[model samples]
Structures are given as C-alpha cells and as structure tokens.
Target: MRIVVVGGGYAGVLAANRLAKAVEAEITVVNPRPDFVERVRLHQQVAGTAVAAGPLGSMLRAGIATRVAAAHKVGDGTVTLDDGSTLDFDYALLAVGSTVEPMAGTVPIGSWEGAQRARAALAALPAGAVVAVVGGGATGVETAAEVAAARPDLRVRIVGSPVAATFTGRARRLVRDGLARVGVEVTDDEVVAVDGGDVALASGTGFAADLVLWAIVSGVPELAAASGLDVDADGRVLVDEFLRSTSDERVFAIGDCAGVPGTRFACQSATDQAGHAASALAAMIAGRGPKPYSVRYLARCVTLGRRAAVAQFTHLDDTPRDTALSGRTAAVLKELATRGAKFGARAGFGA
Candidate 1:
C-alpha cells in the first residue's frame, strides 16, 4: 500500500517515520524543508542556545521518499503540491501544521527560520537594556526563562497572559516563581504595540525595551482549511477516534495538526498520536480492525532556567498536582523527556 503524509512537523514526521517502518509500504513526506524543525525548542533557538534541525532522514527509516513541496490541496487520496505537482495515494494523512498568528494585523511569523531570526535580533541589542516578552504561555515562559538564563544583564519583564492560555494557578504560579528566581519581572497586562524597542501597553504604559519577543502562538500550514478537510474552529483537522480524517476516511491526521482527544501539540502527544495513526492505517491496509486512539502523558515538565523546572504528574486524566518541582532535578527530567521522546519514535505501534 502507498501512503502520503503532509507536513514534516512533529505529527507528520512521527507518523511518516512510524508508518514507513511498520508496513514496508511506500511512504512519501511532503514538506518544504529537507530537515524537520524542532519547534518545541524554538525558544532556545531564538536565544541562540540550541540547534533548530532534527533527525528527518533517520526518523523516516533512512530510505523513504520525500518531496520539497507545500501541500495546497488534499482530497480522498490525492495531494496537490505547491509547485502544481500531484501525488495519488491509497491512504493519505493530512498533518500539515499551522502558520504563525498574524500579530495584531500585520505579518504572521511562520516557520523556524523566522523564529531563529527573531532570536538573532536579541544578539545585537544593548547589553543591559530591558526586554519585554509578550504573552504568558509555554513559549513565552520558556523564552523568558532562557533569556534570563542566557543574559543576566538584561532586565527582563514578562506580561502575564490575560487568559490562562498555558498553565494556571499552580502551573502559573510555578512559572511565576521560576521567572522570579531567574530575575524576570511579571506583569498582568499585554503589550499593544511594539515601536522599535519601546512596548506600549493597552493602559498607555510604555516599557523601555531594547528587545521585544512574541511567544503566544502555534502556527500550522492551514492545510486543513485549504484541502477542504473538516476542521475545528481552532483550525485543527478534525479526525475520528482512530485519527482518520472525518470528511475523508482515506485520509488520516495526527499530531498538533490533528484534533485528537487529550492530544496536544507537544512532542509527547505527537509521538503518542503517531502510533495511533500508524496502527489504524496498518489495520486498514491489512484488512483488520482499526484501533481507537487515546493519549495521557506520564510527566509534564517546564523549565525555568538551566537549573530549575516544575514536574506535573498526571494519572490517566491530564490533571496536574498542586505543587511543582524546581531546580536541577526538574530540569533533568525535562531534558530527559525531550530526548527520550525523540528516540521513542522508533517504537511505533503495529501498522
């Protein structure tokens, strides 16, 4: 059987990698870049602390075919590439991820290339200038923490989210404590405009910032809407319990791009959802019963800096514990989990 996967992101890459190994099937990955962007660590990239590329060739079993194309159209069993080329397949997976959110109304920063460049801006700024990070989600928290860790001289001020977008209460407090430990100042209001390095708040408060960073977005390629797939209001591709595209059974969707229950855009969720997509697809190809998908992460960690972090443990249900961990111990767990999940791609479900 032949299968085509769109987007080389966390979901697409893991699904393609697992499926290629499971069925010995002809697999094709369609993405613009040759290597996958480790988007989860993009904040570190912006801080110039980590590399941006990931193991694309090895993840795909080292031999699966890949095309440098952005999917503009997807159907029952066909994908139309950006270059006007088309690939027909027996089964298709629409994992095309999101694009950056349009900031206010201007250009939406898409791709790690832009993210890396955003971080590069920090390098040339005045050494002891104040830095303002807008948004209070994971990306914002991580970015703030990394900047504080990397540049102790810069006065860092973070505006807490108006909405509880990432974590709340304990989680939010954990982040606050972590930031405080790293010498970052937290504010409750949002920045309305960025003029040069000066950030204007909605209440007419202006922050003298040498660097401004936006950290409250998860962008995909908009393939779900463009391909005519049924998507949720949040712009995720709607899928069934087994990760099959709701509108087209021949198509499967996974990862952050796919709207699966309890499956988030995190690397952990992407890895777990990949097994689900692979199993169901393999079952269909082999004329067996497809299995439904469910996800629950073992431990969740958020890093405060190089030394401290918080570990939120869950039990089947994704409920976090009241207290959190900080310092080197939590940092080690977070680091291990990220690295471990990368290797866990090799252990996929039966196709």
Candidate 2:
C-alpha cells in the first residue's frame, strides 16, 4: 500500500510516523517546508526566545519519503502538489492545519513566518512604544504577557473579552493575575476594525498603538472543500469517530482541520487524532475491526513569559476544575510539555 500525507504539522508527522511503523505501506509526506515548526512556541518566537526543533528529516521516521511542496488538490487515491507534480497513493491523509484569520493592517501570530515578521516588527519599533494584542484567548494572553516581559519598556495591553473564558475559577483568576504581574493590561472589549496605528473597539473605544497583534480567530483553507470533501461551515473537514473523512473513506483528517466534536483547536487533539488514524488504518489493513478515537482533556497550560504559568486542570469534556498548578511549578511543567511535544514528534508514534 502507498499512503500520502498532505502536511507536516503535528498531526501529519505523528500520523505518518505511526503508519510507517504499523504497516508495510510506502508513505510519502508533502509539506511546504522541510523543517518542523513548534507552533505552540510561536509566541515565544515572536518574543525572541524560541528553542530550535531541528528539521523535518530528523523528526520523521526512516523510510518515509518527504516532498517540500504544498498540496493544492486531493483527489481519490492521489494528491497534486503546487509544483504541478502528483503522487499516487492507496490512501491519503489530509492533515493540513488552519491559520489565523487575517485582519487589515495587523500582524497575527498564527504561522511560523508570521510570528517571525511580528518579532522583526517589534524589534524595529522604538522603546516605550505601545503594543496591543487584540484578543483575550490563550494565545493573546500568552503573547501579551511575553511581550511585556521581554520588553518591559514597551507598554503591552491585551484588548479583547474576558481572558480565557473557558477557564473559570482559580485558573481564570490566575491567568489574569499572571498578566498583571508582568505589567500587561487586560482590556475587556472587542476590536471592530484595525487601521493604521489604531484599533476601533465595539465599546466605542479606540486604542492607538505602535503595533497591533491580532489573534482573535482562526480559519482553515479551502483545500478540502474545493476537493469535494465534507467540511463544516468553517472549512474544517468532517471526520468520523475513527478520524477518517465521512465523505471519503480513503482519506483521513486530523489536527485543527478536523471537526472533532468537543475538541478545541489544540496540539493535544491533533496528536491524539493522528494516533487514532494510524491505528484505524492498521486495523483495516489487517482485516480487523477498528476502534473509535477516544480523547480526554486533562489540562491546559499557558505560560506567562518564562517565569510563570497556569496549568488549568479540566474535566474530561474540557470544563475547568477548581484546581490548578501555578507559579514556577506550572512554568516548569509547561516547559517540559513544550519540549516533549517537539521531540516526541521525532520519536515516531507511541513514543
């Protein structure tokens, strides 16, 4: 069997590695870059404190071929690359992830390249310049705190709704406090429009900043929809319990691109779904029954720069619990998890 994985993100790398070990199929991974990016650390990268994750060749298991090209189309048993080349496969795994929804005149910390651009823009700005992060979600909160900590002279503010609405109890309070401890201001408002050096909020408030980083929302590309695959309204591919596309049994979807009910757009779900897809494919290849993907939410870790963090414990369904790990312990745990994610991908599936 020949399997083609159309991405090199967390999900794609894990899925490709698992499949290579589970079966005798020839596996090929097509990605735009030859190196693996630690997306979870993009905020740190923007703050100029990112660790190296090595290249894609070192992470993927041996015998799995890789092509440095973007996948433009996915057809039955085939994938077309941007270079006008096509690869034939018995099955295809669509792990193409999502990106930040772009807003006018604002830099978003979504992709690796975008984060680098934001970093350069921040470094070029003069000291004492005001920097506004337009969002109160995890990414926004983390970015605001990181920027404030990295450049104390620069005024950093987080402009958005309640910080980490999904996190309640102590976790929510800790996130707010962590930001405050780092001299980051949290503003409870919505940004309506972004113009030159100014952001208009829904509360009739305008914040003029030297630079604005928007992390309000994310969006998936049109690759799956254009290829006639079943997707949700947001272009997220719909998948069954086994992580296989409901419309095309020969295709599997994972990561932020797969619409897994009750699962947030997180790296944890991506790795879990990748493992499920690999096992399901192996079961099918062995003429055995495949099991459904079972995912459980444990904790959500958000680092407040490098000094502090909040590891919010969650219920199985992702609802926050009253308990949490905070301060240096949480920061250390977060760092370990971040490092583990990067190196684990290089260790192959089930490592």
Candidate 3:
C-alpha cells in the first residue's frame, strides 16, 4: 500500500515515522520546509536560546520520500505542491497544524525566520526593559517563562482575556500561579492595540513595553480547504472519534490539525495522537481494517524559568491534579520533556 502524509509538523511527522516502521507500504511526506521544526521549543527560538532550523532529510527514515515544497492542493489521492508537484497514494493522513496569530500592529512569530527576527528585535531592547506577551494560553505562558528564564533582564507582562477561564483546576492554577510568582505581570484586560512599543489596554490604559509579542489567534494551514477537504470554521479538519475525517474515509487527521472534541491544542495532545495513529496504521498493515484514533495524556509540565514549574498529572477523564514542583526538581522535569521532543528527532533521523 502507498501511504501519503502532508505537512510534516508535529502530527504529520510523527504519523510518517510510525507508519514507516509499521508497514512495508511506500510512504511519502510533503512539507514546505527541509527541516522538522521543534515547534514546542519555538518559544526558546523566539528567546534566542535555540537554533531555529534542522535539515529535514536528517530526520526521515531511509525508505520515506520527502518533498521540499508547499502542498498546494489535493486531487483524487494526490497532494499537489507549490512547485507543480503531485504525489499519489492509497491512504492519506492530514496533519496540517496551526500557525501563530499576530495581535494589533504586531507581526506574528511562527516560522523560524520570523522568530529569529523577533529574538533579535527583543535583544536590542535596553537591559531591564519591559516586554509585553499577549495571550495567556500555553504558548503565551511558555513564551513568557522562557523569556524570563533565558533573559532575566526583561520584565515580562502577560495580557490575557477571559478565555483564560477555559483552563480549569490544577492546570489553570499552576499556569497563573507560576507566572505570578516568577514576576510576570498578569493583566486580565484585553489588548486594544500595539503601537510604538506601547500596548494599549482595553481600559484606555497605555503600557510602555520594549517589545510586543503577539501569541494569540493561532491558525491552521489552508491546504485542507484548498484540497477540497471539508474544514471547520477554524481551519481544522473535522475528524470523527476515531481520528478519521468524515469527509474522506481514505483520509485521516490528527494532532493539532485534527479537531478532536474537547481537546486543546498542545504538544502532549499531538504526541498522544501520534501514538494513536501508530497503532491504527499497524493494524492496517497487519491485514486488519484501520482502527480509529484514541488519546490519553500522562502529565503537563510548564517551566517557570529554569528553576520552577507546575506539573499537572491527569486522569483519563481530563481531570487535572496538582503536582507542583520547583527549583532543581522541576527544572529536571522540564529538561526531560524537552529531551522527549528530541525522540521525534531520532524517529525522523534514526540513530
């Protein structure tokens, strides 16, 4: 069987790697970039602590084919790329993930190049200067913490909307409390605009900042829409409980790209989806029909600088329980998780 995967982000790459070992089927991955981005560590890239790019060829297994171009469309069983390329397959998995959203007057930082500029731009700020990070979601929280930890000179302020209300129990408390204790200025008010190193608050208050990082409005690739696949209003592929797209049974979606009900977009969730897809594909290769996707998360860890963090271990029901740890202990957990991300690098590159 010939299987094709599109957009080698978290979901796509993981699916490709797992399926590579699962079957003797020919596999092809179509992605615009040559390297697999460590998207979870992108905030560190924005903070200038990590090099932004790694070659894609280094990440793939020996048998999988890699295409270095944007997927322009999907026709029949083929995925069309930006440079007039078409790839056909018997089975397809869509893992086109989301992109960052820019706030008022602020350019979004998503890609490595954009994040590099953002890091340099912030670097130019005077010592002990104030920086504004809008959005209180996981990305925003991680960005704020990474900036504070990586560069102690800058004052970090997080402006969040009531949507911050979405996070509950231990996870919510952990993030908010972690930010507060670590010197992040938590503002509940909305942002009205960003201009001339000043963040305008919805309450008509203007706060001066050395740099403004917009971490809201994360979006997805438009390839699903272009490919004539049915997409939700948010650009996510609507998938069934089994992670197969309802519009095309030959197509499957997962990770941040798959709009799984009641699931938040996070790397842990993507990893869980990756595991799910791995089993399903193994089933398919073993001469059984493809099984549906399922997800279960173990823990959620967010760093507060390098010394402190909030670890929320959860049950299968999504009920979060607190496992707060700080100092060297928490630092080790954060480092371990970061190292876990490196596993994908190995799966792609193969030691």
lDDT per residue (tens digit) for residues 139-197 in model 1: 67777888889888888878754522455467666767888888888888877787765
- How many residue pairs clash per model? 10, 0, 5
Error of 1 at 160 (Å): 2.6
lDDT, candidate 2, equals 0.86
Which residue pairs does candidate 3 place in steric collision?
34-56, 59-348, 59-349, 99-219, 242-293
Which regions of candidate 2 deviate over 4 angstroms?
51-53
lDDT score for residue 267 of model 1? 72
* Most lDDT-accurate candidate: 2
Report the C-alpha lDDT of model 3 over 242-303, residue by residue, as the tens digit: 67777886788777778787677777777677657656766766878765555566666666
Clash list (residue pairs), candidate 1: 97-220, 97-221, 98-219, 98-220, 98-221, 99-219, 99-220, 282-351, 307-327, 308-327
Give me candidate 2's TM-score against the actual structure.
0.97
After superposition, candidate 1 runs with Cα above 4 Å error? 102-110, 162-165, 168-171, 346-351
lDDT for model 3, on a 0 to 1 scale?
A: 0.74
TM-score winner among the candidates?
2
CA lDDT of 237 in candidate 3? 84
Sort order, lDDT high to low: 2, 3, 1
lDDT of 2 at 131: 95
**lDDT by residue for model 2 (1-351), tens:** 999998898888988988888899999999899988888888888888774335888888989999999988898878988899899988999888887876898898878777888999999988989998988888898899888999999999998777777678888888899999999988888888888987898989897999999875578878899889999988999999888889999999988899888888887877878878888998999999998887677799899999999998888888777889999999999999877776666665532
